[model samples]
Target: MDKIQHRTIFVNGINMHVAEAGAGPAVLFLHGFPELWYSWRHQMLALSSRGYRAIAPDLRGYGDTDAPPSSASYSAVHIVGDLVALLDALGLDRIFLVGHDWGAVIAWYLCLLRPDRIRALVNMSVVFHPRNPSRKPLESLRAAFGHDYYICRFQEPGEAEEEFARAGTARIIAKFLTSRRPGPLCVPKEVGFGGSPHTQIVLPSWLSEEDINYYATKFDQKGFTGGLNYYRAIDLTWELTAPWTGMQIKVPVKFIVGDEDLTYTTPGIKEYIHGGGFKRNVPFLQELVVMEGVGHFLNQEKPEETSAHIYDFIQRF
Candidate 1:
């Protein structure tokens, strides 16, 4: 980690903090919610040592990046614009891109919007879902998972933040990072995101107290609203991206996921992935890996294997 270099770059109206290591072909990493550039620390270090430059940015509304006041500001178009701008600012034309969770969603959109700017992509956890032009994203999610589903629950402004506040920042961070529970995460109003202040979340062997502290410290200062805003803007993103409906991602892709991941366990997702729907949407898809027994945070949960998988794929390019 000491080998990594940090800097701030002004991109797409926000000051994005980027962490970089090594000095070869750039491999950019985009992290998901409740995480920071720190989420890619292991990958950054491993890749750097193996002769690839690793870049991980705290995306807009997370970590040190500027948080716009409106959820509408977080549309996939806006976030992808930020990445394109970041690449330009750093003079990178196209690079191998890696994304997880929300980052994976954004990466899919980025490729859809501007494939010329990406060499290839390795997306984790989330698979690209072709846009349903007729229905808003929130509506579909509400119908499928019900209102209590985490994404649906995060739609209302200030609601999730309030529960996060009451639950305590670090506790909530620990809860999210350590959760191995499969299926859709539905936080019923009665239970809250923080199950109980007294509930002790046993840290997984892969995640250290130091890692949780690194994330909690940042969220403690930045607040969860910026990250939650991603969810809050789902409908807007859906509407804005209506034109790209049915557009297939052309870039070569390698999709990896933990079999135990909530997204993986969600009803019909397995069918979607293995049932040929995923490949239909991601036409250039090269490989699909389902890591056994791993959970959503597969990269962090199994850094060595994850990093090796990453190295093997991107090195070919």
Candidate 2:
């Protein structure tokens, strides 16, 4: 961890903070909501030791990166643009992409918009959701999961931020990182994200107090608005991505997910993943591994296995 280097570079009109290690083929890691480059600490060290350059950014609106004020600034196009410019600035023409949660969602768009810049991809948690020509993303999600669903709950700016503030940054970080529940996360307006002041959250063995503090300190400074903006722009992203409605992900890919991941259990998701729908859309998908009993935070909870899964599939190309 001490060996990893950090730097700030101007990209896509924002000063972006990036953490990097090793010096071989670049493997770009993108993190999910409420996460930072630190989320990939173990994988960065593991991959770096194996002679692969590991790069994880704080992303446009998270950590040390500049957070543009408007929700419109966080669309997939904007995030992907930041990455393309980062690659150009670093003199990297192509990279091995790895993403989890929202990061996986961005990786899918990266492959969709600029296949030439990616050598291959290793994605976790979220799967590629093909565009729906008939409806917007939030609408579909609200209809399927109801208004209390987390994504729906995140649509309104300042609403979730207030709940997060009331919950305390450290407690919120602990709740997300240590969560092992497989059901859809729904925070009702009345119940709030704080979930009763009396409810106690126990940290898992994989997550330490230091880790919680690291994330808490950042969120305390930056607030949750920037991270939540990604959700806010979902409908706009859907509007802008119409051209990619039925297109297949063209890069060689390997996907892994915890059997207990909420994404894995989402209605119709199992069918999409195994009912030939996923394969049909991702024709170049090379492998799929389901780790039993694992949860959404697979990279952090199962670092060694996650790193091995990444190294094994990426080394083949």
* Most lDDT-accurate candidate: 2
Q: Write the per-residue lDDT of candidate 2 for residues 1-317, one digit (tens) a residue.
A: 89899999999899999999999999999999889999999999999999999999998889999999999999999999999999999999999999999999999999999999999999999999889899888888888889999999998878899899888999888888877666678778998876777989888788899999999999888888889999999898898898888899999999999999988987788889999989999999999999999999999999999999999999987
TM-score per candidate: 0.99, 0.99
Tens-digit per-residue lDDT, 1-317, candidate 1 = 78999999999888999999999899999999888999899999999999999999999999888999899899999999999999999899999999999999999999999999888899999989988888888889889989999999898899999999998888898898878788888889999999976677888788888888888889988999999999988889988988888799999999999998998999999999999999998999998999999999988999999999999899888
Q: Ten-residue segment with the worst summed lDDT in candidate 2?
A: 178-187
**Candidate 1 least-lDDT 10 residues:** 196-205
Q: Which regions of candidate 1 are displaced past 4 Å?
A: none
* C-alpha lDDT of candidate 2 relative to the true structure: 0.93
Once model 2 is optimally superposed onto the true structure by TM-score, how far is the C-alpha of residue 13 displaced, in angstroms?
Answer: 0.3
Task: Score each candidate by Cα lDDT.
Answer: 0.92, 0.93
